[model samples]
Target: MLVIELRLMQIIGLGTALMMPIIGNLSDQYGRKALLTLPMTLSIIPLAILACNRTTNYFYAYFAFKTLTDMVCQGSINCLALAYLADNISYRQRASAFGILAGVTSAAYVCGTLAARFLSTGLAFQVATFVSLFAVVYMRIFLEESIPADQGEGITQPILKEGEEDNIIQNDDNAPTKVPPFKKIPSLGYYLKARFHFNKNQFADLMLIGGIVATISQLFIMPLLVSPIGDGRLLSIGLFASCVYAILYSIAWSAWVPYAAAAVSTVMVFAPPSLRSIASRQAGPREQGKAQGCISGILSLANVMAPLIFSPLTSLFLSEGAPFHFPGFSIICIAITLMIAFIQSLMIGRAPSTSNAENSTEV
Candidate 1:
């Protein structure tokens, strides 16, 4: 049973990793609002289907649709939102903006989990779906585009080129010819080349490495969802934990979950902003998108792999009848590693006027 579950998770992970980048790329071409709305709206269909599902085949179908929609919504819409925030905010204020976003998301997660526990799963899902749909509608109707239509076309050449007049705008005839649509949207070979040829700056490199390490660490911890004990043993542990959580949640006298969620959210909000701001200050505005994209991509990959990698580890630990020490320890190690990387990045900041020099270069 464990093996089969692990394999299923692996399949899900690979599918997500494969699909997320495509979604992100598509969002880059299309507007973010439409991409975001489609997924949120379509997500209801899968959840609604799952609510009525009674058979294993229906379960599989539900999982497939749900996972695919989540990959599209989360990968593309979420990534674009972050990039949009970065685009709009100055470097100095970005951390605060991210912090607020993180806090809201974290609070929502905690509240959502608690609500799911209290309400019927179907009802809870429906409410959540409606909320998301409403949010999509609100954003579509009211939210302004941060990136101008013209600005989002692609990277513009920096104003100040060496030995060239700063204000000069070359005629269309003098500009390089645009590639044909076929060449622009190349086959697999071209896609691979484009992906691989991304030029990363120091901060981008740090983000990519940090993202990979953070993801692998998180993945190592997630499989413990089944616990270190066998399914029979883990079931009791999960039930107990859920019961305790439910009781605490029901009391409603204190905001324990919300507070914890706020802390976690705050961390997430600040971490990226700090990383981006420091890196952008070092690397410049132009390369910020690539750094953000690469980081987002790495995190998405990690999200995909977490279940696959952790499920087996959890099974192995459970088979051995040992307490699940690895998950906590792995998370600690990852935190330390990220902290060190962040510190190292700060240390590297003392170098000569490197900020604006590389900002305008295309990644």
Candidate 2:
């Protein structure tokens, strides 16, 4: 049962990796409400099926439906919500908001797991269906549309465009910027091509840095140092810890070595939210959705690639073939990746801090 569940999750993760950016981009155009509503409404069907039936056919049906819907639902809500916050909040406050949001999610996860201990399987799923339905209804009735149809072009603008110059073009009747042709449904090939146009090695290295940083800081230390060090510096600390964790894990001689190395990894939990906060601050008013989507896409890509990159090497070295008996060989490669990320994090830390005055004056 555990192995089946793990495989199911892995499949779902792959789906999420492919669909997240596309769905996020769609939400930017059609408004978050509609896109958000469709997924929530569809989610109930699979849960309700599981609640009522235990037959093999029903289980397979549930799995199929869930795999499809989970692709749409998993990260879409968070991406849209972060974009919504970007629309409303000042950049200075975004880091705290992101942190609080992450905290709320962690609390919800803990509560749900604890609650599951008390409820039967059917009851748990039924309760989830009901909660999902309630959330959909509440959002439909109460959540005002954050992105309107007319301003959709704003979202499609190049994220790295000069802020002041873009604003000038927006204000002037004579100097209109050329609008790229809008595709209501972007092709999978187009998305893959556009999303991954960067140097693969560099991208992989940077993601490893961010991933390790986020894993260690957010999971272990961010809760403690978030207020004191600030998000960017906390990210730097997390990256440094990740570098250390990688090195230790690589050279580890005993099983206990990996366990000890993990102790130093508690600082990475802050990386994700902190990075989101910084990216949100960088985007223009209407560009938040795009920026956040890009971030999510990068994360998903990393999730898809990490196992492929690490598993083979680990397997080869651990097998009975006659090579140097280094169990830590795979870990050394990981450590090197972490080092690249650490250097990037340091550069980010040393970059000029944006004053509230500058943010306010930005377009």
Candidate 3:
């Protein structure tokens, strides 16, 4: 089962890696609102399929459609949204903007999980399908284009050569930033099941607690922190917390420990918006979509590598035929890897605010 999951993810990741850059770069040309329609509309098909039936034939049909749709839908929505925000918000204010956006998404996660806990499986899928349809409708009726369709003239959007791009990326001069792995991988749930014996109910509860904390932290705490310490330090703190979160999960002595780790997950939430803020400032005004797309593409490529590294390690450690008795070994390696990235992140000085630079130019 685990091997099957790993193979599925490997295929999904490769496809997503290829697709994200194309989606993002297109957003740069066609406008964020135009690109948004593709992912949102396609996402509903798979959900609607599952909402109708769940026999073995239906299940396989859903799986096939789900994989194909996710290849285009997975990272594209958030990537384009970030680019849209970049178009409207000043660089100095963007970290908070991104944080607020994340908070809203977290709130939705909490609500969906809470709703699903009581609903039957089929009903939950039905509700999800309706919600997805509503979201698409709302977007089409209410959302305005951040970039005009006519502005998508050139194919090339430069990322590597600009002076600002150098400032954005050069802080990791000694340590090139490899994509830090996260909850996107399937191994974490398998590790919990294999080790401490967590069930679906327990998983939902854990996620709810984590989602609540993350929503509060991103909505209230992050806005305040982003101004004082800046994106660099906040990212560093999130990375450290990420390491700790994995470490706690790795050595979880009791079931309660995972709950404690849930609280720690809030700090880890700070990293993505901070990274997005940093990445957004690197682009020229028209290039926001291209910059964010590049970031998503980089992450997709890392995700491609993640399961390959962890899945086999996980199988060996969790199985009775293991070379050693450490069931949590794969997670420990995950933590160690994060710790290395966190240390390297410390060397990253904050990219100077593009808005402030613009203001100075005006004066």
Residue 223's lDDT within candidate 2 is 46
Quick one: RMSD of model 1? 17.8
Q: After superposition, how far is residue 57 of candidate 3 from its true place, in Å?
A: 3.3
For 1-363, candidate 3 gives per-residue lDDT tens digits of 756776777787788888888888888788899999999999999989889999898889999999999889888898888888877766668789988888877888888888788899999999999999999999999999888333332221112322555453433211101111244333788888778889998888877887888889889888888766677778888999988988888788887888887777778888888888767655566777877888887887787787778878887998999998888889889989989999877765533334333432210
Candidate 2: residue 5 Cα off by (Å): 8.1
> After aligning candidate 2 to the native by TM-score, how far in Å is the CA of 133 from where it should be?
2.6
> Can you give the lDDT of residue 242 in candidate 3?
89
Model 2 spans with C-alpha error above 4 angstroms: 1-14, 148-228, 245-266, 349-363
Each model's lDDT comes to 0.41, 0.58, 0.76
Task: For residues 182-252, write the lDDT of model 1, one tens digit per residue.
Answer: 00111211111222332324223322333333233223322232122212222223223323322322232
Error of 3 at 311 (Å): 1.9
Model 2 TM-score? 0.68
Say which prediction, candidate 1 or candidate 3, comes out ahead on lDDT.
Answer: 3
Off by over 4 Å in 1: 1-5, 18-22, 51-58, 149-269, 276-291, 304-363
TM-score of each: 0.55, 0.68, 0.86
Looking at model 3, residue 275 earns an lDDT score of 80
Error of 1 at 215 (Å): 22
